[model samples]
Target: MKLGFIGTGKITAAVVQGLCTSGIDGLSIAVSPRNEATSSFLAQHFSNVRRMHSNQQVLDHADIVCIAVRPDQAAHVLSQLRFREDHIVVSFVSFLTCHELVRAVAPARQSCRAIPLPSVIHHTCPIPVFPAIGPVMDLFSTIGQPVTVDNETQLHALWTLTGLISPFYDLLGSLSDWTVSHGVRPDTASQFTADLFQSLAHAARQSDPIAFDALAHHAATPNGMNEQAAHEILASGAHQAYRQACDRLVQRFPILDE
Candidate 1:
């Protein structure tokens, strides 16, 4: 497949990295000129990747065009490009509806919205949603697990879930900092927190039919250290604060109508 990326940002770089590392055959990537450093880096490290002179060149030369621009810049970028009827256009920009994509690339037949994280580079599980279209399903599945959604609302929900990752990381960082302040070495604190999460993730994956809440309850036994910490967090409303943050993200999702 001849693939082109319209905005060469972090996500685009991650996707290109994933594709290059996956050893998938017959793949050629052309990246936009917006992030010159990333585009040049990919071209230098990957044999099949090239840097296009302009975004239009990406649309003109590639069979599958990916729009990776920020939501605010999407309309302006689309307004300046052209696409053929048979071209497949996939967007990583959240909340832009398929209809909006169709209108952007006027004559395109296939349009899809996909969400991919940096984890995709390792072929680890990635949250991918395509409202419609089969090719995107097949393509992303090669890089990670892919889920198909039937409507735009579900796609928006998926996007909100993606937005949760950053704050989750911040929460972990706070926990790590707390440990460091308590005299744990900084490196040891960070490593311990990372390993703890890794172990928890692995446990969740391995424990079939075991409910997560049940696992947490078991870990937080009556009068135990875990239970005491949990109580303090709940009493301080930290959990509620996280929930409100998530709610705000849902409210701020960048729909095409905006």
Candidate 2:
């Protein structure tokens, strides 16, 4: 399998790192030289990966080309590149629908839209893909749980959820700070706070039906501390605020009228 990436940003770097360490045979990668530091780092660390002088060079180097450029640069960047009919392009640019991307990468009959988290470096994360392109799906499955959606609306909803990464970290940071204020060591506080959430998530994943309310109810016994915390968080409308924030973010990806 051969892969090339047009942009060497964080997500691209993560994907490259994961794929290189994934132990897949006959795999080679080429990355554009736009982000010299990242491209250099990958080339230096991975034997199968190399840096290309231009986006066109990257495209020519691999059968599958991934676009990781910023949303603002997507149109301009792709407009300048030439694609082959056999090429399969996967785009990481937000708000660029598969249709728009297909037009941008014309001559390329196969295209996919995807956004993977940095956790992919560990070969474990949710990778949301659209249209269920088989090769793209198979490739992502090697590194993460590839969840394919039938419609763009659901894809947009999933992308909106990605915005919560920072807020989720803040929640953990706040809890760690609270413990530090009580005289706990900073390292111990951070580790305990992170482990608490990770364990909770793992437990929730084990639930057969995976009902959040059911899990919350189980954790929050009659007038227990867990119940107190849940009550305060929900009663303050923090949960609803997350929904509203998602609503706002989803608006950023308007339905592209055909």
The Cα local distance difference test for each model comes to 0.85, 0.93
Going through the candidates in order, what is the number of backbone clashes in each?
Answer: 0, 0
lDDT of 2 by residue, 163-251 (tens): 99999999899989999999999999999999989999999988899999899888898989999999899999999999999999999
lDDT of 1 by residue, 40-130 (tens): 9999999999898999899888998999999999999999998899899999987577788779988888888889888887777565666
lDDT of 1 at 204: 82
Candidate 2, pairs of clashing residues: none
Q: In terms of TM-score, how similar is model 2 to the real structure?
A: 0.98
RMSD for all candidates, in order, please: 2.3, 1.0
| True-vs-predicted CA distance for residue 178, candidate 2, Å | 0.3
